[model samples]
Target chain A: MAVKAVKRIDLSLAPLVENTRRVIKGLKLHTICDSGNCPNMHECYGSSTATFMIMGNVCTRDCRFCSVKNGKPQEPDKTEPGRVAEAVVKLNLKHVVITSVTRDDQDDKGVFNFVETIREIRKRSPGTVIEVLVPDFGGIEELIETLVRARPDIIGHNLETIARLYYLLKPDSSYFRSLSVLHMVKEFNPDICTKSGIMVGLGENEDDVIEVMRDIKEIKCDIFTIGQYLRPTGEQFEVKRHVDEDEFQRYEVVAGSMKYAYVIAGTFVRSSYRAGEYYQKYQESRKG
Target chain B: MKEIILPELGEDIKEATVSFWHHKEGDEVKAEEDIVEFYTDKANFSVKAQASGILKAISVKEGEKASVGQVIGEIEER
Candidate 1:
């Protein structure tokens, strides 16, 4: 019974913006910021913010620790939702996150290119606030109710680690099919804020991280991102211990006492890192 | 010199493949160690030496591909 030594937080690196490289070269679109070597991609593209990795850049499910790129998958650029809505209207971003790569070789697994890139980034970034880090189509509740009927205010899905290292770091993923795709994304829209994330060092156990925060708060998943898994490649998956900074502030006080309306546990949290400062502090805590 | 580049390891990783080189053009390495090894589409990676000297020029070759932030080598500061 000897296991409690987590303390490693040396985060302070952020600088890289030329309008985030001119919105990925004027939306020829493709990001996970240079394919996932994301140590918060230089503090979220040095604060101009960027997270768009739309349906391409190849990946038909290989997930070891992900550095995106699987093979033979290049056909779904049907104008990549109007070139990611003209690079989210030329990077005047207010909050956007779109993600992709697990096309399982098509057949709806790409969810119609994530519902036409969230309906052309909500008709050309009008008010911009879309977020989508998806991929659980294998749990297909009609493709997670068609990306919650193309209504993306936020709908992330990443049970990245835990549940006994989900078969050694996402072995074709399925920790109860990613908690049934975040319990069917709040049974398909309960205000649509069903986020999910986890990646604490690799040898999970604090009761498997409080049973994955009680299975993502019984699948209500409002939002939660606990980072630090840093192993990006050595054949992928081997940072068996580095959960520090006071255990990410005790996992944000145990995911805010299990009532996660927002919980970004540290070590440089990712999953759209400072996602517009946590969606503006979750819209001022739901307008108080 | 500051030119270690080569990162962007995820979300549909468009190019990496190189896989092997842990230091050459004069060696030295350190800041984050593991100098070179790549292959992405979700695994097999190792580019760490963000800063800590000597390995001056490698310019993508092990099996080629590179791309992402692209530079592949050049450190020189030992």
Candidate 2:
């Protein structure tokens, strides 16, 4: 394995603002930021923005790197949709991101909740642009169609790692299945911006990353995010390598050249990081 | 006394080097106040105190690497 030289960049941390606190407390909703301990929480919340984790925090799958607890998931909260709507109205955010923990235990894999959440948010906050980061739903075509019908501004499904590390890292998820999800999203609505992301330093080679990028492009995914993977817990997988700043820049160039509409690559880049900024950029690009 | 375990930074980070500590044992800390700085593959992050208390012990030293889920220090509740 070639040792990549690491460069440490100083990140400007943002403070949590009052609007962020009100939304969390008012809705009584849990976020991946609080549950997973996202480093960008300060910056995001400080900006009065947040990615809401709907359905519930407990995931059905036991991914090694995810911090969300796993087990039998609780039943979806029927009132969560209304609460989320209320929070959006109160926060007065220009952009909204709603994600969920994978709930395979349910028949629809929590598709109904996703649909209702979008509906409610649109109803309550008509001007706020909405984005959703959803799970594969075990390749259920109906579930994908359901989310498509809801008409979110952006529909994202993370291809968490390269195919070579898929089994080792995401034993329950299928690399091909995830690709299919992204492809189907665009197939259902070509206008809807489709997005996916992958983590680096999981022992995947440059070729592996390139292959995944090609696969994503083949599916016509519009947006791509590549970030360094930090093991969520000690009991989880060990880090195979630390990708440097230069490598991230190289990946960004590769992704852009592949014709992805927008690409964000770096250590702190998450699926929802600077999501509002990107969503605006996509809209502007489409206008031209 | 409650031990403050090293937190998981993201999905793939398993171990992190202790970059610095904001307070020594016996220093009073406010609830949610940041106590230590650690470097992971992603970035250098501060571990905050979950409860208001006194720094009781430092199990991990600066520049040392700690695995996620391992206790790095202990805090005595105020």
Candidate 3:
């Protein structure tokens, strides 16, 4: 029998999808969902949820697997913080995920934008939850501290792939540096949830994936998500294999056993997928 | 006469509720202009006029449900 395949849901005709696109366009905001060509774009947009990309769409580093544009970026927009907050209110998002392209050229590596955006959201929408999927900030402790000081509800940094393949996939980034980014967040403030994710199907074996999980566990990271890597375009890295549902289930079982605060493993799962629900669950767990 | 049929909304969406009509019956509508908005459990979608005409009838009232391809209204083409 053939293995069951997980596929992206088709939502092109959804009216709210068009409306959300219009809002983002009108507000002049960029979203990782659009910039990265995320598979869940239409579904997320239809439901009025989007991962806002700050700083600018251009990135400083070229990652082989990423779809975001890599080039010298323009100066960060001063009005972006307020506009993102306004978009949160307009979309009526209870939880919003903010991410940005890697800006290695900047002195602070765009930490200021992250901090200001968090402050703006808190000022405008006190009750709304903020989650930031951040770049490594070059693993600088003070830059990390500046963002931690802003107090986003959750901070996520994707490991992107296993350690051995890290150099091949993310040539400009360091695997150890990415690990320290998650480790430092816990060190700075354990109260704020720390998250990291990895992509599979880029020619890694199960043992390699397990070793990465153990590494994450060793750092005491709180949340873990794993998903199959779908090739975005011919220009980017090609998928080594199509991981089936059974493998995803086995990974889920393995991750669950590792004592993460929460773990989601599947073909369709992304680090920021249904993040609001996970935050709610994390909050509930805290109460209990 | 052009029948205003609800277009296929793609994947698992079977029906929608008429949320609002941008124009009332007997109002002149331009081709490609949105005339009605329908909402499902997931999203609110706007339907556009196929051609410039006068809206002659509304088979589905506001807050009423409609199925895919159902004629919810009519337009008398100029």
Q: Each model's DockQ?
A: 0.09, 0.11, 0.04
Regions more than 4 Å wrong, model 2:
A1-19, A285-288, B1-43, B46-78
The best-first sequence of candidates by lDDT reads: 3, 2, 1
What's the i-RMS of each model? 10.4, 8.1, 12.1
Top lDDT model: 3
Candidate topping TM-score: 2
lDDT tens string, model 2, A205-239? 88888888888878888888898776655566777
Which is the winner by DockQ between candidate 1 and candidate 3? 1
Q: Rank candidates, DockQ, best first.
A: 2, 1, 3
Q: Which pairs clash in model 3? A: none
Worst window of 10 by summed lDDT in candidate 1 chain A: A5-14
Error of 1 at B47 (Å): 4.5
TM-scores vs. true structure, each candidate: 0.31, 0.78, 0.77
Please give the distance, in angstroms, between residue A185's alpha carbon in candidate 2 and its true position after superposition: 1.3
Distance from true position, residue A147, model 1, in Å?
17
Question: lDDT of all predictions, in order shown?
Answer: 0.73, 0.80, 0.83
Better of 1 and 3 by lDDT: 3
**Candidate 2 clashing pairs, residues 3+ apart or interchain:** A230-B12, A230-B13, A231-B12, A231-B13
**Model 3 / residue B12 / CA error / Å:** 25
